[model samples]
Target: MYPINTISKGGLALVLAAAALGVPLAAAEPDDGELWAGAESRIQRHRMADAVVVVRDALGRPVEGAEVRIEQKTHAFLFGCNIFLWGRLPDAGMERAYRERFAALLNYATLPFYWGSYERRRGEPRHEETERVARWCQQQGIVTKGHPLAWNNADPPWLPDDLDEIRRLQMERIEDCVRRFTGLIDRWDVVNEVTHFDRPQFVTIRAPKHSAMWERVGQIEFARQCFRHARAAGPHATLIINDYRTDAACERVIEQLVDENGRRLYDVIGIQSHMHGGVWSNAKIWEVCQRFARFGVPLHFTETTILSGQQGRGRPRSTPWRSTPEGEARQAREVVRFYTMLFSHPAVEAITWWDLSDYRAWKGAPAGLVREDMSPKPAYQRLMDLVRGKWWTKLSLQTDQQGQGRLRGFLGDYAVTVTAPGKAPVAKDFSLARRQTNRWQIVLP
Candidate 1:
């Protein structure tokens, strides 16, 4: 048997006792449609306090639909995917093998609208591929997040040549892309990486093709303009200003954005968490996340991955993290540790993998949950266990105040009951799992 990490005696007891209870556990139900409608419809309705609280009882069951004791909510997890070049370009054939992998892993698919990739040639956008992916994602009941509608890397060759054409062309591209994928995507990242602290802003990396839109338009103004344009073309899309490095400056810019008077440039505060320098201590991740929680904008752990055993720095880098079985096993254990840690965080809404497989992963790190062959890795199974296998279960609550029982938990189907309160106790089951578009539902009252 593979060695599992150590846990507290109490936690270990929860696991062992549950395993011993093995008496034909109920098969976890697949999600149903119209279930998350309340949540989805409210996406554009509220820009602030966009999180939910998670709680549990003595029993180790994931409870759902618990009343918010606190006005502030911290949605346990809002699942997502980040469209990186490694996920798309050239070796996408490898992606074809793992279609089911992505379909199951994400509730939202984030498409990066790099100015160069979207409109490699003037007046010619990658409309075919964009529509193809967007439509498919919608059919699968997956909400869409269009990344970086405005970015420094978004400049076309013609854009940098003439300053006079920057605003006109930038606006035109934004309009075209937004219109092209209208209504299909629910959220759009208006800007990405605007703050430059220790690292350079996008313009520095893109070089000679830099723009006045980045330097002169001002990050906030650019974000506002992009959000306005995106809204004009695609109504009801949540706008976001996503940044990588979580420094004080980044926090300031995000705060400036969410708190602005007339222009609330961003709806969701997108934060990236690609921790390749070994697993980050729990405290570190929490510290960064808590800051975003202050702004009251729902937080999305936008683009994230933990390398198994790679060596590289930033965008242009090298080495695969897991080339052997031991390495692969280590990668798997890390995935569980990282996921369990993040899932427990209140502020983190979503955690997206840059790629589903290493076939075309940026700098080729074994960061994917599965292998290129579509085989399940330890990481994949752990995710399946959480995301699919045990999405819903029965929970027990010991009564607290006023003869009423109170407990905290996740968003999913749950059955709760009292064992020894009044004469003979009572039980209540709340089927709260989000309904799926593909499945049929018959409500039982």
Candidate 2:
């Protein structure tokens, strides 16, 4: 466990209040010197808000209905995991199983756009296959986002070694993706891992080809340019500058992008919490959110990974990782705890697990929600319980004399059913989008 360097001042007070109400808050002091603090305070009591919907007759008059049922088909919270390997599955059955697990629990998905893989040969991109998957996700009512439009590591193999050409090509790549996917997959990671450009890992030691590009154009400018290009290509897209860094330096990069009028360069802040080192302490997680919340932009846990396996030897990035029952149980608990913290935080809009299955997990670490055999691990079951069970909304009620049905629920897409005495049942579809009243006036013929 990492030491808790920062703590939210209000957390203790909130915890005390919850304790006074007889709510049990679990706080564990892990052997790794990390304190999982304020678990109970993080559990939000008011995730569902009041939504008033009125059933009306065709003539715009309120009509009493015998039965009213509201079923949430998807979440607006953006529970997502990467589907990078979904198209690569050799076995059709395995692919179906993977898609089933994904569609069952997730409403948002991250598709791979690593430049090298997306366009292995110059001038030829596998847009047909990519578009095919995007359409499939749309059919399932799932929103899709391209993993990265521009990255230091997303270098195509066939590209020339010239630095200027690389820079030009990078911008072109961003333009191509945004133009091609446009509305189908508008949200994008316009630039990834920019903070590490000047770090030793990138500049001096084991420098990737992107380091030269970074050195030439300057790190921050390159990122800004990427966002500009992506925005130009997909004017309505949500562009984000995603980084693995969560410290003050990362915040400064965001701060610098703001102008005198306090306008932000990116629409969303993408923070990666790949906790292969260990699950972040509740204090650290909360603190990070508090710091980034100052930016006044929605935060997305863009590439999250919590290992269900033993710590690897030597450096944090290790291979051939193995999973154990004990590790799986620990992983499950942390998943619930951390997710609760993120969901409760007012600034967080999305949280996406880096990879979906352990078989192809980065560096072979057991960081997947499911096992290689496609069986869900304890972590998967626990996540499902939270997303589809505890946090889900399902209701059956009747309209009052005014033909108004009062109800509250988590925000998202919903399926509505209306029935009247001696009349055929009517089915309708509605969405409880962000803001507004979420109130609807459904008419019966």
Q: Residue 74: error of model 2 in Å? A: 1.1
**What are the per-residue Cα lDDT tens digits for candidate 2 across 1-445?**
1122223333553355334333333454233123235433333432556677788777888787558889988887899998887778768877888999999989898988988788889999888988988998998888999988876564567877788888898899899989988779989998888777666665554436667877889878888888778878988999888999888778668766654466777999999998887888766776676556655567899999888888542234444567889989999998998898788665688999978888777877888899887789999999999999888889999898899898877877789888877666778778875455778667778
Predictions in order: lDDT: 0.56, 0.78
Best by lDDT: 2
Kindly provide the TM-score of model 2 when superposed on the true structure, using C-alpha atoms.
0.87
Question: Lowest summed-lDDT stretch of 10 residues in model 1?
Answer: 436-445
- Runs in model 1 lying further than 4 Å from the true structure: 1-77, 83-96, 197-207, 258-263, 311-322, 393-445
Model 2 pairs in collision: none
